[model samples]
Target: MALTTEASRYRPSAIWQLRLSLFMATYVLGASALYPEVFYTSALIYSHKFLVGIPVLFIGGVCCAALIHGRRQPVRYALDLAQGRWRGCLLVLLFFFASLTAFSTYKIAIPSVVPYYADNWLADVDEWLHGMPPWEIVHKLDSNNWSSVVFNSYEVIWFYQWFGTILFVSLWSDEIARIRYLCAAALTLSVLGTVLALALASVGPVYYHHFVGVDRFHGLNAALDRLDHSYMVREPAAYLLKAYQSGRPSLGGGISAMPSMHVAFAVLNAYLLSSINRWLGVLGWTFAALILYGSVFTGWHYAVDGYASIVVVSVIWWTTGRLVRE
Candidate 1:
C-alpha cells in the first residue's frame, strides 16, 4: 500500500477515528443497552429525545457537510491535518464534540433509559417553571432591568466549552488522547454534577419545590429552550436541548439544580483564561458573576449550587491544567 504522506504518518488519524468511533460507540452502546446504569440510578424522570435526536442528527450532519462546502479551502488544511500537520486544530474540534456529547450522554443517558426521579424534583421544577412571572422592577436601576452590563463576561465564560478542546489540542497535540481523556473527564463530571443537582438534590431555591412568591427570573431557561427549538431536530450545535423538551423540563430538568454546570464551565473558563490571557481573567470573573446572577436571577440554580459548581470547576480546571501540562 502506498503511503499517504509523512504528515499522515504522525497524524493521529487512527486515534481521531478511534476517538470519534469510541465517542459514539460508548454512547450508542450505553444508549442501546437494555437498561443503562442511569436507569437504575433513580435520578431522571421521563426520557424521550434519544430516539428523536438520531434522525435530526443525521440531517444535521448532512447540513454541516453542505455548509462546509463553502469553506472547502479548509479542506486542504484538514488534509494536511490528516497527514498530521494541524493536529491541534483537529483535536480542538474533536475535544469540543467529544466533551459536549460525553457530558450530555453521561448526565441523561440514565434518565432516558429509565427515568427515576420523574415525580420528585423533575415534575416539581417543571410545574414551578411553567411560566416566568413578569420582571419586577424592585429597584429603578436601568429601568428595573434587573440585569447588569456584564462586559466581556458572556464571551469569556462561553468561550471555555466552545474552545476548550481547541486550546487543549494546541498544547497537547503531541499527547494522544489527552484532549479526549480531558473531554471525557469533564463530561463525566458535567453529567454527574448535573444529575446530582436535578435528581438527587431534588431541592432548588425556595421556589421550584414550593412557591414562595419570589420571582426566580429564569429567563435564560426559556431562552435556552427557544434556541434549542432550532436544533431539536437539526445539528444541535451543543445539544442544548437534550435535557429540555424531554417532558417536564425534559432530561435537562431532571438534573438541573445544585452544583450548576453553568457555574462549573464558567469556572473552567476563568482558570483557562488566567493562563491564556490576563484580561480574560478579568472577564472570567465577569463571566462567573453572570453565571451566578443567571442561576439565582433565573431561579434555575440555588446560590449554594453556584458555590459548589465553582468549587467543582476550580478543581477540574486545576486538575485538567496538570493533565494537559499547559
Candidate 2:
C-alpha cells in the first residue's frame, strides 16, 4: 500500500518510539551489569549482523514491494521516505534492532546465570499433558518429503516472516495499530523471550540429553537423523551446542527452551496481521500453527512451551491494544 499523507498526519508521537528505545536501553544496562563480558561480545556480533543484513533485507523488501505495487509506486515510495512520512517506522526499526541485540545477549547468558535445570521437569510436564512426549505426536508427520518443508518453515520461512511482519506493520496506515504492535512485540521479546526465559530456563528436548546427562530423547534425535531432508535442522542445533560449549557469544548462540520464542513471535505476528485483513489473518495463524508443530517435531521445544507462548502472546496483544487506545 502507498503511504498516504493522511496516514502520515496520524502517525503517533515520538514518545511511543522513545518508550521502545528506552526499554531496550534499560534491558541492555541490566543485562550488562549481570554479564558484561557476554553483553559486550554479543553486542559486537549482532551489531555487525544487523548492519550488513538489514540493508540487504530492506533493499530486497523495497524491490519486492516495487514489483508488487507496479512501476508507478516507486516514485511515491521514495517521496514518502524523502518527506519523512515514514520516519516513525524507521525509528521503530532502529529501536527494534537495539532490543534484539539485548535479547540475544541475554539469551546467551541464560545458561551462565540460571543453568539448564528445568528440562526434565518440562519434559515430564509434556508427557503428563500429552500422555507421551510431545515429539512423539509431532514426529508422526516426519518423513523425507515433509521433513524438508518443516525444516525450511521452521528456520528459513520463520526468519522472513519475523522481519516481514515488522516491515508490513511499519507501513500500515493505522498509526494506533502500528504502535500497539510495536508495544506488544517489545513486551513479548523482553518479557517472554528474556525474563521468563531466565526464570524458566531449560534446554528443550533436542539438547535435553546433553544438558541433563540423559539420553531420553535419543529416539527422537535418531528419527530426525534418518530423515534425508532434516540436515538443516540438525546442523544449527549442533552449531549452538558448540557455541554453548565454547562459552563464546556467536550469532544466534543462546539456548533457552521453555516458552519457545519462535512460537511466541509467530503468535504475535498472527495477531498483528489479523488486525489488517481476514485472509492475511488466516495466513498468519496457519503459519503460527505450523511453527508450533515444527517446534515440537524438530525437538526445539516441549509442547507446553508453545502452548504457554500462545496464551501469553494473546494476553500481551490484547493488553497492548487497550494501552495504546487509551
Best of the candidates, lDDT? 2
Local distance difference test, candidate 1: 0.45
Query: Which ranges in model 1 have alpha carbons more than 4 Å from their true place?
Result: 1-95, 105-195, 206-255, 322-326
Where is model 2 more than 4 Å wrong at Cα? 1-15, 70-73, 79-86
Q: How does each model score on lDDT?
A: 0.45, 0.82
- Locate the minimum summed-lDDT window of 10 residues in model 2: 78-87
lDDT of 2 by residue, 1-326 (tens): 35686565455534565676677679868878877888788878877877886666555655566566647778677455435435655665666677777888889888778877888888898899989887878888777888888889999999989988887666565677777888898899989999899999998988888889999999899888899977787899999999988988888888888889999999999987788789989999999999999999888999999999999999999988776676
Looking at model 1, report the run of 10 residues with the lowest lDDT sum: 135-144
The true-structure Cα RMSD of candidate 1 reads: 10.5
lDDT of 2: 0.82
